[model samples]
Target: MAIFDDEPRKKARPHEIGQDLSLLSVDELS
Candidate 1:
């Protein structure tokens, strides 16, 4: 993993969860 991201992406789960939750407030359009 890249510490914040990942290669295969599985490792990015933590990053994704954090960002996704953070973005949720502004992601109402999506």
Candidate 2:
């Protein structure tokens, strides 16, 4: 699926750390 492919792209980039942090905070808060 497209979703599965997109996940690895995000994980592959170090620059994605900022995006990951934002998502992680929201996940933790909820």
Candidate 3:
């Protein structure tokens, strides 16, 4: 039987998501 990769990855926490947004803002402005 072939093993299936069925488990979904967990979402990032609020702090991590915020950090990503900040990085995106910097890139857009520059």
Residues 1-30, model 2: lDDT tens digits: 889776765564445456697765554454
Per-model TM values vs. the true structure: 0.31, 0.38, 0.37
Tens-digit lDDT string for candidate 3 (1-30): 122221211123344456798755554454
Cα error, residue 18 of model 2, in Å, equals 14
What is the Cα-based lDDT of residue 15 in candidate 2?
53
Off by over 4 Å in 3: 1-19
| Candidate 3: worst-modelled 10 consecutive residues by lDDT | 1-10
Off by over 4 Å in 2: 15-30
How should the candidates be ordered by lDDT, best one leading? 2, 1, 3
**Model 1 lDDT per residue over 4-25, tens place:** 3434355444555688866544
Clashing pairs in 2: none
